[model samples]
Target: MNGAESLVETLVDNGVDICFANPGTSEMHFLAALENPRMRSVLCLFEGVATGAADGWYRMKDKPASTLLHLGPGLANGLANIHNAKRASSGMVNIIGEHSTSHLKYDPPLTSDIEGLARPLSHWVRRADSSDTIAWDTVQAVEQASQHPGKIATLILPGDTSWREVSAQVELPKRVAAQPKVPKAPDAARIAHIARVLQSGEPTLIILANKATRGLALERAGKIAAATGARLGSQFFTARIERGAGRVPIERIPYAVGQATEFLKGFKHIITVETREPVAFFSYPDKPSLLKAEGTLVHTLVEADEDSALAFEILLDELGAAHAKPVLQQRVEVVVPQGALNPLSIAHALSAAIPENCIVVDESLTTGRESMGHTMGAKPHDLINNLGGSIGYATPVATGAALACPDRRVFCMVGDGSAMYTIQSLWTQARENLNVTTIIFANNSYAILKAEYANMGAGVPGARALSMIDIDRPSIDWQAMAKSMGVPSVSVDTAEAFHKAMADSVRTPGPVLIQVRL
Candidate 1:
């Protein structure tokens, strides 16, 4: 078998069957090897889409997905989403193609430092030295990616390594059969201390993130809040959160520095679970970077690599709150708005139209600021936010989520500005026929930047400055764009029309786009 074939076989045996690929000449052998029916290869027009899709897949499947990139430049193109995936703690295995060892001596044009490009975003990085070692390297990459909370693993494959023949007599190294690593249980003394703090009757907030924000871990946190008077909260941006009606409600910390500071000022203590103390996304003039109030004691209940569910269980036992019933969010009946399509109306429309058990990938910087709050009492669903503060993550992530959970629909909400960054994602969605409904809030500008300008202590923007934030010079026809990519689409200028579009898109099969004109 060739090195590429061996690598593909290893990936499938390790439970990584899906590959999002954007290949070049260096990956020809690997591309040929992908003909193996056991491995499903998806073509992404851009490397960023591939990486972002892998992130989405990991979030939904709780497993690693592989990505195939051409070279250093290709890996560089995929880095932004890799940054997003890393911040989200999504597991991904990236196979980056490299020029042959012989070609490096000539200093080829495509040659660049692949390792240098991957290190900042990847948890593990390795290069296949020979055909015989490719299988071993592939196994290591998959293992790294499969860790709890997930990790990014980049495996660089040189051209010679991919094409070289391996003798039939050479036996590939077997993966040491073992169970995946479980998160360490929190220290008993630490849980006892936290239990005491919770019972002190002091106002406290338990901040949740990562695995702690969902499932039984969330339930345990809710019980703690019920037994004590402490509130349950989450960071402004989280990787994946299971929320809405019938689920235990957790307060979302405000995103703006002033608003967050105001919201947090009432707390006397902040207990963290699998996340750190709250902090502002960016520093502004005359503003504190840390969001917690002065003199507030911060305690860590669960470390990132520690088991949050176990810690909560221990805390529950210590507090005698094991039988406490957590409060759940009740369903709210939202009436669909009619005329204007402002933020409030838009939020109401979404709250009314969203289906149950769907996935919501949110990157609507301007319009979706209030979406989470409005949708809190809607149907139960999984919500994914961009933790890395990167734009253009929603559509691609939605694409991946749909692939991972074929039975569920995916709603992608993104602004027009952010949508343009990875608009190529729509084509992949269409090609895959993924069940994704992409909503574009077409304000035709980087509206968030305009808000940030004032937030940063800058005065009102002049005409020239406004020009940089506006994109209305020639308004983009989103319907035409979607149709060109083989995805059906519609345009709406009113809340009612947009709501109808959302409801209708869910019933329709395959990918669809809704352009909400502001």
Candidate 2:
């Protein structure tokens, strides 16, 4: 058996059934081994799409998928999304192919520092030293990626390793049945300390993130808030948050420093669970880096690696609030607004049309910032924010999410500029016949950059400066773009038109793109 075959077998044995790949020459053997019907190989035109799709797959499937990237340059192209995946705590196995060891001394044009590029984004990085060890390395990579909150495990494979003959595949130890680690219970002293702070009834706020923002943990958090009169909030940008009608809603700390500061203004204590204390996304001139008001104390009930759900349950028990019914958001009627489409009208249209059990991938930049509040009580859905602050994620993530959960509708909201970066995802969505509704906010400019320039205290931009952000030199025909990619699409300018387009897109099957022109 060759190393490539054994590597593929190892991954499949470990439950990694899918691979997103943008392969090249060095990966030829690995690519050939993919002929095995057991492993599904998805061809991504760009490395970023491969990585971003893996991120989406992890979020929806709760397991890591493998990605095959070309050498250093290819890994470099995919780094931004890898960075985003790391921040989201999404698990992925990145298989980067390198030149044969002998060729390295000759300094091939493609040769570069692959490990250096990978280390920044991956929690674990290892290179297969020889063909005999490839399968063993593959097994280790899967284990690293399967941890509770998920992680990125990168394995660098030299070309010679894949081509060489191995006597036999590594005989990995018999797998142990994985039991969800029983979270180490918090001591009575710590629980009492948190309980005391919450019961003090003096403006305590609980910040939730990661696992704490979804499922039963969120419910217990709501109960704690209900019993102690403490408030609940989350970071402005989070990986995935379960929120909608009948669910306990959390006040997300605003993206703007001033607004976030005001949100946490009077709180005397901020309790953190699987999330850090509130901090601004960027340091504004003369603005405090910390979002909370001065003199506010930050306490941690559970750290990033701790089990957030159990921690909150313990806190609820300590407060005698286990049975307290929490306040939940009532269903809000979705209404189609009249007149021209603006941010507010756009939000209203989405609030009305997003389907129940839907997944919303947001990269709408400035336009969709305020839209979350409007969708609070529409229907139960999962909202995925760009925790890594990287652009071009919405479309690919939507593609992967739809593939992961075929029953749920996937809605991708992206701004014009960001949409262009990964527009190829639309073709994949169409080819796979996935259920995806892509809404491209065609404001025809980098709206967030313009806002940032102003926020940075820079004076009004000149014609040249404005030209850099404005995308309207020759307005992009998004309808044509989608149609060219084999997806049905339409352009809409008014709120009613957008609402109709969205509703139609969701009701119908396959991929559809709605270009909302403001």
- RMSD (Cα, Å) for all candidates, in order, is 1.1, 1.6
Off by over 4 Å in 2: 169-188
The lDDT, on a scale of 0 to 1, for candidate 2 is 0.87
Q: What lDDT is reached at residue 2 by model 1?
A: 97
Question: What are the lDDT scores of the predictions, listed in order?
Answer: 0.92, 0.87
lDDT of 2 at 123: 95
Question: Lowest-scoring 10 consecutive residues by lDDT in candidate 1?
Answer: 172-181
| lDDT tens digits by residue: candidate 2, 1-518 | 78888788888878888999999999999999999798988888788888999999989887889999999999998899898888888889999999999999999999999999899889999999888878888878888888766889999999999989887534643232122334455456777899989878899988988888889889989898889999999899888888899899998889998888988888999999877887788777888898889899999888777777788788888888889999998999966798898888988989999899999999986899879988998888999988888898888888888888889899899999999998989888888898999999988899999988888888799999999999999999998999898999988989999999989988899999999887
Q: Please provide, for model 1 over 271-336, each residue's C-alpha lDDT reduced to its tens digit, 9 standing for 90 to 100.
A: 998888999999999999999999999999998889999999989999888999999999999999
So what's the TM-score on candidate 1? Answer: 0.98
TM per prediction:
0.98, 0.97
Superposed by TM-score, candidate 1 places the C-alpha of residue 177 at a distance from the truth, in angstroms, of 7.3
